[model samples]
Target: MLSSALKAYVNAIDDPYTIYMDTEQNSGFQEELKGSSDFEGIGAVISKKDYYIQIDEIIKGSPAFAAGLMMLDRVVMIGSGLTKGLDVNQAVSQIRGPK
Candidate 1:
């Protein structure tokens, strides 16, 4: 399938920051990066840092801020899943959803 082919091509290049996202993934990724007032997820901006997902910013009055998460905090896990091998897109998708 096209998805697999795209993944294979990206993997061939071996760029951690270069990822292929499907339509839905791109939509969610855009929403998360835009800093919209009405947002889902933990209300924190994140990025891939080394082998982990790092929280770059905690939005004011959001669940993440309420939970006392700080900038540069490395997220090792999401629920029961480890974040070690996940790219930024995958991490964002996992983090975004209804409260």
Candidate 2:
């Protein structure tokens, strides 16, 4: 109840990238973001939280950055809502692609 209420407050704030992570998840995420992977997206790093997709970072030179996407932008609708209601995995699959 407490965490849900807190999350609701934060979610109301409009910063999509900020999500509460427990200690273990935070530590693992810390290690993961420091490394490189061949995965591709709109040049933005994102994670799926409870009900929304969170964009963590926009690579400086990536297309997403060029398009003016900023950190903490909740993905509301994508591709004219073609990807709406998709789970995190499905959303990522639709948004990410080969560069």
Candidate 3:
């Protein structure tokens, strides 16, 4: 599951952005297969000025859908062992795979 802070970051944005997935050789593919095949769990690129946590487009079910996440929901934490920092690059890293 994604951290609350990361979720909040996604929920606070209100703008048209592109979500991308990293395709690195080291990334594990078996784990990604555990989730829905349709959604490869990729990274997103939201606008910087879009409040970062509260906006209209940020709402769930919208074009910028976050699968199970909702809009305006702050992401306060992530991962199990360590509280990893939440950023666009990090988000992309999580969803990316070996290409």
Top candidate (TM-score): 1
Instruction: Give the winner by lDDT: 2 or 3.
Output: 2
Cα deviation at 43, candidate 3, in Å, is 9.2
Ranking of all candidate structures by their lDDT, best first: 1, 2, 3
In order, the Cα lDDT scores of the candidates are 0.74, 0.64, 0.36
lDDT of 3 at 58: 37
Better of 1 and 2 by lDDT: 1
lDDT of 3 by residue, 1-99 (tens): 344465456546733352222334114223333444554443222222232322112333333365544433443333442223445445444434443
**What are the per-residue Cα lDDT tens digits for candidate 2 across 68-98?**
8988777887776744456766776677543
TM-score of each: 0.60, 0.53, 0.29
Candidate 2's TM-score reads 0.53
* Tens-place lDDT digits, model 1, residues 1-99: 997798679758876456666676556546767866675777766766579998766667878899999877899998789999899778877877344
What alpha-carbon RMSD in Å does predicted model 3 have with respect to the real structure? 11.2
Q: Give the C-alpha lDDT of model 2.
A: 0.64
Clashing pairs in 1: none
What's the lDDT of the predicted structure labeled candidate 3? 0.36
- On lDDT, the leading prediction is 1
